[model samples]
Target: MEYNLEVINLTKNYQDFHLQQINIKLPKGKIIGLIGENGSGKTTTIKSILNLMTYDKGNIKIFGKDSRNLTKQEREKIGVVLDDSFFSPILNVNDINKLMKDFYSNWNEKFYYETIKKFKIPDNKPLKEFSSGMKMKIKVLCAIAHEPKLLILDEPTNGLDPIFRYEIVELFNNFVSNGENSILMTTHITSDLEHLADEVIFINDGNIILDVLKDKIDSEYGIVELLENNFNNIKKEDYLKCLKYKNEWYILVNPKYEFQKKYPKLKVRKPNLEELMLLLVKGE
Candidate 1:
């Protein structure tokens, strides 16, 4: 399958932190969830892909062309929404519309206006007057109005209520329906990824720990709740991670290994992405 974006052995080092040997691919028309804890290098990886930060090694390709080689015209096909607001605090929505119109060659005034109205963002209200959720909506609107082929979003759901978060997830679903658009969303909210992500890349401490299809994860990893007494019998090497809550111990095991047969009394169940991520990151 052709990829919209690919990162090959990417590495970036900072004074105190480093993004080491990161490899990721964003397949065309798919929404990839980049799951990681804070300071896990998600933003650093995104910046390296966009060439916003210099990497010590490796290559990033967008549309099969090296990202570093892409000219302004080529780069325009990608849209980005970071954690912070890029628009000036003093600028109102009207000012932003005019500013972006001059910035992007393919900027669509009609779409921008329609989105602002659909999101209920007041055209005359200054950015500083808008709530965090409203500002995030504006950022999303600006990114989509230009009709970019690939979008890179960093914590787009931050500060959003549950209702609006669902709305944003639906918006992303609609965006990728065009069949030419792809999204790489880095977010801590794993619940948002349950229904939306086709693929998930787990990052921890600047390194990718797991990269797998969402469906495969659901089918493979089982959460086995064993009695405290039985925990000592379970082989620690066989499980990916384990946690103990009071008298019961919850273990994440590969279902292919026949964990149920070995521990018949253990309550084996499927785990969601969030639980799996917590286990991977916290070693529990």
Candidate 2:
């Protein structure tokens, strides 16, 4: 019933871009997907929550404690995977496993080796000799084998094949099924989120465009296509974004009863996550 992580009024200013007043609540036993374009402050937000970067304003809490106040034991309960891995390239998989066993208080040696076997990762080969996908698999294995309460990942399945992506997502599903763990992942691949995320947070240009349950997306939001003649009749306030191309107006709107009553003849249809994302980011 409690949130695993809370980000409130988060803001950070830079010379060229700003992460402004972002907020999110990630409940335990749920996976929340974060989607945004490159340089849209997705990584910045994650880093801010991890306290890897200094923020100018707002509070970030994990497991009911301010992130900065977490003890070594508390910090160990968070398993993280960034866009890049931090393991030394010269270290082989066996070496990494040995290091991890010593680092985490409750490291599961059985689970770690099982994961390596499942992933088909070579224990004797150094990371530098592995492909990007292989290295990513190792990182994922390391994160999950520790049995953390929360997993924060960025682009965790970037280079994997479709089958493995599904497997990894299945792992996420299993991780949260017990209602004791949760995950917050930022991914450019909306399809992955569509399959795994219970809720989604869409950010654009450092601002939150959407943050809602995935099921509510279809029921509450839609795209409306209007003929050229009717385009001028629709009010701008009704739609979140609009575009005029090929003599038709494409608009995304909440489809409230009032808007539908006003234009019963308008064509409104449900959009999938990827389509909706595109309309919001590129429609205007």
The best candidate by lDDT is 2
Measured on C-alpha atoms, candidate 1 has an lDDT of: 0.87
lDDT of 2 at 135: 87
Candidate 2 has an lDDT of: 0.88
TM-score against truth, every candidate: 0.95, 0.91
Encode model 2's per-residue lDDT on 24-71: one tens digit a residue. Answer: 899999999999899989999999989999999999999989999999
Candidate 2: segments with Cα more than 4 A from true spot: 225-238, 244-249, 256-267
> Model 1 off-target regions past 4 Å?
none
| Candidate with maximal TM-score | 1
lDDT of 1 by residue, 109-173 (tens): 99989888888889887899999999999888888888889999998888888998999999999
Report how far residue 35 has shifted in candidate 1, in Å.
Answer: 1.3
